[model samples]
Target: MRILSGMRPTGKLHIGHLVGALENWVRLQEEGNECFYFVADWHALTTHYDDVSRLKEYTRDLVRGFLACGIDPEKSVVFVQSGVKEHAELALLFSMIVSVSRLERIPTYKEIKKELNYKDLSTAGFLIYPVLQAADILIYKAEGVPVGEDQVYHIELTREIARRFNHLYAEVFPEPDAILSRVPKLPGTDGRKMSKSYGNIINLEISEIELERTILRMMTDPARVRRTDPGNPENCPVWRYHQAFDISEEESKWVWEGCTTAKIGCVDCKRLLLKNMKKKLIPIWENFSRIDEDPRYVDDVILEGTKRAREVARQTMEEVRKAMNLMF
Candidate 1:
């Protein structure tokens, strides 16, 4: 099966990115599926158009993170979204098919505008990002897209665009389905959704000393004033980290019992989580360190992947042109 997914190149990835997307992507590639993972640089511009300075650096770092997390370039095609012109071409065609009213009606559109505190999000690019997303999926005819539930509406919109194109022109693209990741939302140290914009994220490239400090500083049950006070693990972010990192059912239960019975202090609980987390993180740090030193290795991967992706994209565009009678 051909699977398509991507992440925006806004900043260095964090633990939330690891648990939410990278882990699932690695699993899919290991399963022998044809995976196309790209750096969504164009998508980043939709919201971050004001800043172009860090875009290149972020794109490179994102690719490095993919390599560090075991997304093999041999098994998966990893490219930049804007590397091939077909994406924009198809996006332009799709923009004509999707109605502006429909784009405005998307739940996240208004939410994003408000979240960013934009007095007006009336930009043509911002509104039609979903169309570009649909083009990204359909251009490859991806059978599945790995995403969180927050992106279900975008996938639905992709399906709608595919349906409209096939009905109007030819059956050129498949309506991809959303392959939901079962991973829970990895919260920040502040117990909110881990995001760079929030300034609460623990970046993947953090030093061991920083990691220890970050975990120790993580939000716990505010109601628990003393080590003797019983706490609800459900309300604690440390408990959430344990759920994702600690694979041992017995140890997990131990954490629950210890926290609830006031048998262990929050410091002890964080130490346990830190131990398990380091066991996994040490290898990623090692890999990223090696990859970071070798810039040409990342460049080679992007170039090769772009070559492979363009071959498929060009063919799809040919068919699209033939169907729409655009070729003179």
Candidate 2:
């Protein structure tokens, strides 16, 4: 089955990105499925259009991160969203099929408005992002889209658009289903959602010294002021990291019991979590080093992927033109 997904080229990825999407992408490829992963440079504009001078640089960094995280270019079609013009064409055609009232109804639209706190989010491009996303999926006629629960609504919208297009003209697309990933929400050192915007993320390519320092400084249970005071592991953000990274239940059990009974201090608990976490990231760290050593290799990989992707995209667009009677 053909699967498609993308991430905005915002900045360097953190642990949240690893568990949330990259790992899932690698698993799908290893399972012998066709995967199309791209740097969503165009999507980044829906919000960050004000400053794009660094956009190209960020896009390159995003691809490097993708490669470092084990997204084999040989097994997956990886490219930049803006590299293929068909995405824009399909998105424009899809815009006519979807209603303004419908776009306004999407829950995320309101959320974005609030998040940005911009008095006027009336930009046509921003409003139609869901339509653009639909183009990203249907242009490939993708069978499945791996996403978190927050994105299920967009998948529903995509299915509706596909159904509308097929009903109006021809069966040119397969309605893609949302494959919800089992991604744990990793918190930052500040005890907030691990986000670059928050300045508390532990980057994927961070040096060992920085990684250790960040883990050591991470927020723990605030109520347990003294080492002797019994702590609540449930309230500690560090405990969350332990649960997400520690593979052995026995180790997790040890951390839980030790923390709850005052047998272990916050520093000790963090040291254990850091130990388990470092082993998981060793390969990614090595890959990051390799990518830095040879930058041109990353460029070659994206170019090759774009070449392969364009071939399929062109075929799909031909069918799309015929379905809409635009063959002339």
Among these predictions, the greatest TM-score belongs to 1
- In candidate 1, how many Å is residue 308 off? 0.7
- Pairs with backbone N, CA or C atoms under 3 Å apart (clashes), candidate 1: none
- Please give, for residues 231-281, the per-residue lDDT of candidate 2 as tens digits: 888888887777677548888888888888989898988888888889889
TM per prediction: 0.97, 0.95
Score residue 37 of candidate 1 by CA lDDT: 98
Q: Candidate 2 regions off by >4 Å?
A: 118-120
